[model samples]
Target: MCSGDAATVPGGHADRPARPQPHGSLLNPLHLLYLACFLSQSVFLSAQFALLLYALQLPLSPTMAGLLISLGGLGPALIAVNIGKFIDRRGARSPMLVALAAQLAGAALPALSQSLPVLFLSSFISGTAFIVFRIASQQTVGRLGDGSTRAKHFGHLGLVYSVATVAVPLAAGYAIDHAGFAATFLGNALLALLPLVAIASSIIAIPGPAASAASGGRGNSAFALLRDPALRRLMVATVIINGAWDVFMFLAPVYGSQLQWPASRIGTLTGSFAAGAMFVRAIVSLLTARFTSWQILVMALALAGACFALMPAFVTLPLLLAIAFLGGMGMGVALPVTMALIFETAPVDRAGEVIGLRTLINNVSQASIPLLAGAVGALIGLAPVFWGLATAMLGMSWSSRAYWRSHRRKGQSPGGTP
Candidate 1:
C-alpha cells in the first residue's frame, strides 16, 4: 500500500497525481481544474438566485422564504465533515461526480414543479452538492503543488470564484427576468454539465486518496487535527472572517432595501465587493512574495474591521460601494491565504478532512450568522450589528498577534509559506 507520505509535501516539493506534461499552452492542468471550479460555482450561485426569485414569485411568506433558502447552507453544515472523511478514504473523484450530479438534479427539480417540498429538497441538494464539489476541488488543488505554488494556485482559484460571484448573479437576474424561473433553474442545471465533462476529459488528474487514509486511528479524528496550535488559530480566524462576510452579505441588501435603493444599486454595492475581491486575488501572488501568509491574514482582518467600523457612517451609493470594495479586498486576502495555510498545516493524509472542517465551519457561519444578524438588526439596528462585528473582527486580529510574532522570531523568513 502507498503510505500517506505519498501525498505529503516535504522541503517544498509535493507528491501529486501523475499527469501528462503541459504543452506550453493555456489549456493546462491547472487551468482545466479552474474551469471545473468556475463552472460548478456558477451553477451553485445562479441556482441560489433562481431559487430565491422563484420562492418570492410563489408569494411565500418572508419567513418561509428565508427558511427555504437557508436549507442549502444547512445541508452542507450537517454533512461537510463526513464528506471530507469519505474523500480522505476513497478519493475526490467519486464524491465530486456524485455531488455534481446531485447539483444537476437539484437544479432541474424546480423546472419540474413549483411545489414547496420540491423547492426545499432542491435547495438542500444544491447546497450540499456545491459544498462537496468545492471541498473536493480544494483538496485536489492542495495536492497539486508545494507551499508557494499552492498559494498561487489558491489565489487563482479565489479569482475564479470572485469572477463567478460578480458575474453569475447578474446573469441569473437577467435569466430570471426574461426566461422565467423554471427555465433559469433549468439553465443552471445545464451549466453544471460542463464541469462533469471537464473531469471526464482527464485534462487534470485529481489525486486519489492515500492508502493510509483508510487506516485511520486516533489521530485521524477531524477535531483531533486542531491539536496543532497553528491550525487551531487558523480555524478561529476562518470563523471570524467567514462570519463577517456572511453578515455583510446579509446586512447590505437589507440596509439598501430599507433605504429604498433600487436592485441595480444594491447589486452595484455587492458587485463592488466582488470586484475588490477579484482585484486583490489577481495580485495576491505578488503580495505573498514579499510577506508571509500570516502577515497578510492579520492585516486583512484589521483592514476589514476598519471597513466595517466605517460602513455605518456612509449612506451614499458610491461611498458604500467603495467601503464594500475595500472590505472585500481585505477578506479576499484572508480567505485563500487561510486555505493555503490550512493545507500546509494539516497532515497530508488528512488534508480533505481538514478542508472539510473548514467547509463545515464556513457553512455553519453562513447559515446562522445571517439569522442572528437579522434578529439583532431587527431588535437594535443595522449600524450596531455592523459595529459589533467590527469589534469582533478587530479582536480576532489582535488574538493572532502572538502567533505571527512567535513564528517570525523562530527564523521563518519573509514570503515563506506558513
Candidate 2:
C-alpha cells in the first residue's frame, strides 16, 4: 500500500508540487467537499428509487427488480480497495471526475433504452461511481484536520447524509409520479453535472501523492491493518453497529405491516428515524466536547440496544416511533464517531485504505443482512431478530470496556490524541 516518495503529481497531474492553499481562501475545500457530496448523493439515491419504480411499472419480476438494486452495491464492494489505492497514488480530483462521469453515463443509460441488461449495467455503474466519490471525499476530509476539527467535519457530513436520506426518496417518488422514468433518469444525469463541474473547477484543493510519504516508512497492506488490536476492535464494532442499522431498515416495514400500520404511518415512522439522526448530528460537536469519542460511541450502542430490545414489545405508533427515533439517534452518533476513531487511529498515509475497508464492510452488510434476517425471521419470528440485534449491540458496548480502559490507563484518548 506504500509508495516510495511519490513524485509531486499535484491535482493528479503535472510534475509540479501542489500550490500552497491560501489560509483565507474564500472557498474552503471542506465546504466544496460537502457541496459535491450532497449533489452526488442526491443523484445516486434518486436514481435507485426511480429505477426500482420504473422496473415495477415495466412489470419486471420482483426478483429481477431486486437484482437490479443489488447490482449497485456489488460493483463497489469488489473494487473499493483498489479505488482507495488509486486515490492514494493519484489524488481525489481526477478519480472523482472519472467517477462522476461514469455516474452520468449510468444515469443516462436507461433514458436511452430500457433493456434489462442496460438497466442492470446502469445500476452497477451509478452505484460504483457514487461509492468511489464517497471514499475520495472521506479521505480528503479526514486529511483536512487533526482530531477535534476532523471529528466536527465528519459530524457535519453525517448531517448532510441524513438530510439526503430524508429528502431524496420523497423527491424521487414525486418526480416519478409526475415526469415518468426516462425524464427522471435524465434529470439525475443532469444533476450529476453540477458536482462534476464543481470539482473540475478546482473548488477543492486535493493534496497530491507527495503528501503520502510525510508519515514515514512503508505502509502496511490494508488487510494487515487488522493486526493492530485497536483497529481490529473498531472494525468488529463497525460490522455489528452497521449490521444493526441494516437489520432495522429491513425489519421496519415488515414490523409495521404486522401491526397493520398504513403506508403513511410507516413512512412517518421512518421519517422520525431520520429526524433523530439529523438532530444528533447537528449537536455532535457539543457532545464530543464533553465526552471522548469512544465514550459517546459506546453509550450510543447501549442506547440502540435498549431501543431494539423494547421495539417488539410495543405496537403503538407513538411508542414505536419513539423507539425508532432513539435507535436512529444512537446510530447517528455512532456513525460519525466511528469515522473520527478510524481517522485518528490509522496511519496518515493509509487512511484511504482503512476507509475502503470500512466501505467494504458496510457493503457486505447491506447485501447480506436482509437475506439473513428474512430467513431467520421467517423461521423464528421477528422478535428474535430484534432481540438478536439487541444482544449484539449491547455485547459490543460491553466488550469495548477493555479498549476505553486501556486508553485510560495510558492517559490517552481512546481515539488517540485529542
Candidate 3:
C-alpha cells in the first residue's frame, strides 16, 4: 500500500500519496521533462492565441480563419489516445519529443507560410503537440510527486501555468504588435526549446505497467472508461463542465469586442478569465482543506453555470469582474475534481495514461465547441449561446448525484474520492 505524505505548495494543501524510495532512475528524467513542459507552456500562452487573430487579420475568411484558429485543437483530438499509449509503454520522452517537434512545426510553418493551408496544417500539428505536452506533463506530476503529494505538485504545476497565463499573452501580444509575425512565431519556437532542453537534461523514463496496464493501449481505449457506469457519468459531467469553458474563453472576448469594449480591456477580459482561473486554483488550494473535492466541485459547477447564465445581465466591467470571480471560484473546484476523478477512477498504474487520455478527450471538446458556440452566437446572438452553456451546466448539476452513487458503490472516501 502507498503511504500518505502530506505537503503544501504555493496555493494548495493536500494529503499526499506515498511514493516508493527514490530509485533515481526513472524519476530524475521525468522531472526534467515536467520542468520543460512548465516552461514551454508558460511561454506558449504568450503568443498562442494570437495565431487565431493573425489568421483573421490576413485577415483570413471568417470561416477559414476560425478553422485556422481551431486547427491546433484538431490535431490533438486525432492523436490524444496515441499519445497516452506511447507514454504508458514507451514513456513520456517519445511523445514529448514528437510533441515538441510538432510545436516547432506549428510555430515555424506560420512563420514561413502566407498560405492558409499551411497555417491550418501547422495549427493542427501544434495543437496535437500541445495536447501531448499536457499529457506528458500531467503524467510527470504523478511520477515526480508522491501520491500523497500529487495534489500539492499538481497545484504548484498549475500555479506556474497561471503565472504564465498572466504574463505570456501580454508579452506575446506586445511582440506581435511591434515585431513581425515571423518574430512572434520564432518566439514561440524559442520557448518550445526550453522543454526540449529540460527533457534532455532530466532523466526519468516514461512509466509503464508497474502502475496499471493500458487497456487496448491508452490511446484507443478511453472508451473503456465509459464501461464503468460511474466513470461514464463522471465523464459526461466533465464534458459539460468543460464545454462551458469554450463559451467563456473562446466567445467571451468576441462578446466583449461586440460590446465595443476598449482593445486593452478586451485583452484584460480574456486575461480576466485567466485571472479567474488562477484565482480559482488558489481557492482550490484553500478549499481542499475543509471541503471534499466532490463537494467543492459540485458547488463550483453549479455556481459557474449560474454565473454564465446570468452574465448577460451584468455585461459591464464591475459586473463582469464579479461574474469572473464567481466563475473562478467555481472553477477551482471543477478542475481539480475532474482531474482527481480521472486519476483516481483508474487504477494507480494506469493513472498517467488515463489522465493523458482525459487530456485528449478534453482537447476534442475544447476544439469543437468554439465552432458550435460561434454558430449559436451567429444565429441567436452571444447571450443565448451563454444560456445554452448555462443550461448544459444545469444538466451537469444532476451529475453529482450519479457520481455520489458510484462513490458509494466503490466505497471511495469523500475528500480524496480515490
What count of clashes does model 3 give? Answer: 20
Best by lDDT: 1
lDDT of each: 0.80, 0.79, 0.64
lDDT of 2 by residue, 1-418 (tens): 1111254322211112234323475467777778888888998999899889888888899999989898898667778877877776676778889989998999999999998888889999999999999998887777665554556678889998888877899888888889988898999899889888877877556765436533342455789877777678888888887888878877888988988889999888877777778999999889978876778878999999999999999999999899999998998888887887776676655676778888997788777887899899999999999999899888988878667887688765554433
The 10-residue segment with the lowest total lDDT in model 2: 8-17
A best-first ranking of the candidates according to their TM-score comes to 2, 1, 3
Q: List the residue pairs that clash in candidate 1.
A: none
Please write out the lDDT profile of model 1 over residues 202-246, one tens digit for every residue.
Answer: 655676776556566235568887777778888888888888888
| Model 3, TM vs. native | 0.78
Candidates 2 and 3, the one with greater TM-score: 2
Greater lDDT among 2 and 3 belongs to 2
- Badly placed stretches (over 4 Å) of model 2 are 1-26, 213-220
In the predicted model 2, the residue pairs found to clash are none
TM-score of each: 0.87, 0.90, 0.78
